[model samples]
Target: MDKRRVVVTGVGAVTPLGNDAETTWNNLITGVSGIGPLTRVNADDFPAKVAAEVKEFDPTDFMEKKDARKMDRFAQFAVAASIMAVKDSGLDINEENSEQVGVWIGSGIGGMETFENQYQNFLNKGYRRVSPFFVPMLIPDMAAGQVSITLGARGVNSCTVTACATGTNSIGDAFKVIQRGDALAMVTGGAEAPITNMSVAGFCANTALSTNPDPKTACRPFDADRDGFILGEGAGIVVLEELEHALARGAHIYAEIVGYGSTGDAYHITAPAPGGEGGARAMKMAINDGGLKPEEIDYINAHGTSTAYNDKFETAAIKEIFADHATRLAISSTKSMTGHLLGAAGGIEAIISVLSIKEGIIPPTINYVTSDPECDLDYVPNEARKQDVTAAMSNSLGFGGHNATIVFKKYN
Candidate 1:
């Protein structure tokens, strides 16, 4: 009774860099930063005034205007990315096998913009003025719900809410579902639209956001000058199919997800455990689950959040888990370009890891001007490198001390 094998057949993304996967991947490879001055919200209101926002996005381009109206921006991004992924996979969700398809999309904070607006409406007007779609749009699970309804996926519809690790956990859980024979194919990832007055004020109050006014250099992950993470918004999705199902359909396999590991610090509400012990365990679990030696890892897409504690702790965690191989593996933080997408960070980073395996190139960690003594590693800095990556790992550490890692291998 061997477990099933799951492979990524298609990828899609809606990020500040691009509206689709190819565009985003190209920008990432070219070392372009999508973060810019915060415009969606008034910059004058907050000390931290920059964000990575999906630019020039037209919801009607992906869904009917009326249909899009009911969904929060987060769910809209999810649905759009899901449609692209499913279409890219050439999956025909007909009645014959529609019931065998599932959708699992996660969001760290869903519809904060909607929540703020609806609350204001309630305050200014009355309870009667609030739209009925408020609750549906504000819940984190609505991304999965909307994707399922739009794609007609009837199997095991679900969502994971692991704060910043939501995307990785969602994808990991989807992999398990398919591996255990729960579905033939799945649309899974994470979405977020967290830029709002309350969201900004909350992070500002905690001093968790970067104070840098220049968007280009604000999110310098792994750099000594990095102050804190810059908020970002968007979505990333992948069409995961049973190996046999994808093979039978002649679908293009981007990469195979071979391992998933998750752990909790149980030490803090916001900070990682001392020395990133929990993250180390999650990394070890993922490596072991993949049945690979630590030295075999070619690259790491780090959860380098640009926060002082995270940068130092994650570096220590990597050294502890990878041992001598820490210096050998090429590591980078795409957040240097895309800003921290919160829950959606892992989703897009996972896509980038798969693309790295498929394309033989590793994206760079831009804005690496200065070095940090505690964070010493070969962060593919300033420029993308051409490397024949055989195996790649993506790490996502969230608030509440949640840590998750997912391993991807070149589909040989």
Candidate 2:
């Protein structure tokens, strides 16, 4: 039997650049950096004082005020983006097909803000002062559970927690569910709200964050001057439907999800495998799964974290995997603008990949002042470009040696 076809019908995002998918895409094309001085807490002592924090976000805009108060910032972003995705997909899972719809959202570290706040409350006041919703709010799976309840999706509901690769794994697993004829629809993506003191301290202690004070100059992926990644927060959700289901309903089709591959380095707790062997395998698996030749790939949204090791290794992996085609492909790291959204990085980058397939525009990697010889590639360098992208892939590499790659093809 042949695998079932899957298509994306709707895309939604709450990013540092915009509150909605359209606005975010627009900002991405225009080369806007969302990173700024950290405002969620006092960053007087931290070396990396800037991040890509979401702006002008009000959970009450999508849900009731009372209900919003009960949710962590991560869950709040999940609910908000899911609502937009459902509305955009025009998928009303009512009495007819409620059982056939599913929700799968992932997060690397969920509700860090909540954990910090509740711990502070416990220390300052008492254990009794902590809210009863603490556990549910901090759990990573809450995003999927809340989204299922919000839209009445009764199909397979779960969350993938693969560090920064969480979002890509979630969407890939959901796509497999549909391809195997297990479900008809899945609301899947990633969300994260890890901009808290503990989160900052943990990353800073590990020396994973960029110490650059100027937010605009920070997160310089693939650049010789890049020091480290800047933390970011956001949510990105996509409504994926069976091809027949979407066509039957006349839903808007953004692009088709053709390939997904995931791998583990099994070599490190916080670094990629030597020379990105795991990452190369993931990309090769994705291309094979998509049944596309290396030459068919037109663009790549790199997992360039602006760290020294990642930039060098990921660049090497791409060149090794694609060989001569490496130079022919247009690749860039949108993290240069949005900073690193952690688990949500793959989610929004996947959305951008689909849009590039549909709109024929490639977003740029800003803040690229100087180039490294080892990290040589087009990188769409500093400006958006107009091109007919036939196929696009997004790569996400995370701590714990997790690597995932998803390929999107222009629906012909």
Candidate 3:
């Protein structure tokens, strides 16, 4: 049986840079850094003093005050972004077609603040003191559930939880659902609000966060002086539609998602495999799945997390998979400015890749003042470049050795 093609019709993002896709993309191409002094938590308590935090977001703008309070911050973001995405697609989730529109959203850690607060309430006051919405608000699947409820979609509602690979994996899964004729249209993406006390303490305890005091230089991916990734929070949502359905609705297609690849390192819990072997295979698989050669890929939105091992090993993986073509590819990590969104990284990076195809330009890896010998690629450093990008790849590598890659092409 022939597979149905999947196309991205609308995208929405609430990032450290901005609250909407257009705002974030504008800041991204202009080489802006969203990292700032860690304000959500007391910086004096931890070694890491900086983070990329979403700014000026008001849930009441998207949802009713009562409805907003029932959701955790992550769920609020997912619902808000999905609302924007669906609106952008101009696809109505009416009673007639609502059942055909599904929702798949994911998160790394679902409501750390909710868990912490409710746990304290339980410990101090007892189980009766906990809010009735505790379980629903604290679960990672709430993002998907809330989105489905908000949009009134009923066909397939699921969430993928693969650590940092959650967002990309979820989107890829939704794409397969459409390709397999499970649904006509899908609301898919990832969301996170990880700037909580427990999350910070956890990453700090693991020493996976940058200790840099300066916000601008905290997340310098592939740079020689890079230390580790900076924590960030945000959500990215996209409306994916089957080619015929989208065309029948005359929706504006951003790009076509042609291939998806995922793999597990099976080596360590918090580290990538030696030389990123798993990641390399995933990249190769995506290219093969797309029926394209490495030489045909114009650009790569790298999973360069700015960590010592991640940047080095990911660079090695790219070279191994693409060979000489890696040198010719215009590769860059937008995480250099956005910091690491963890689970949400895949969604936003996927959007960046799609926008690059639509606009024929590539965002840059800012703060690349010095290069590392191990990471020898054209990392489109510091400044955005004008390039006619026909095909692009977006990669996401999670802590559990989960590696996912998706290939996107200009909608011709």
**Candidate 1, lDDT over the whole model:** 0.93
Scored by lDDT, the top model is 1
Cα lDDT of all candidates, in order?
0.93, 0.92, 0.93
**Cα-based RMSD of the predictions, in order?**
0.7, 0.8, 0.8
**lDDT per residue, candidate 3, 189-223, as tens digits?**
89999998889999999999999999988899999
Backbone clash pairs for candidate 1 read none
Off by over 4 Å in 2: none
Q: What TM-score does prediction 2 earn?
A: 0.99
- Candidate 3 TM-score to native: 0.99
lDDT of 1 by residue, 187-243 (tens): 999999998889999999999999999988899999999999989999999999999
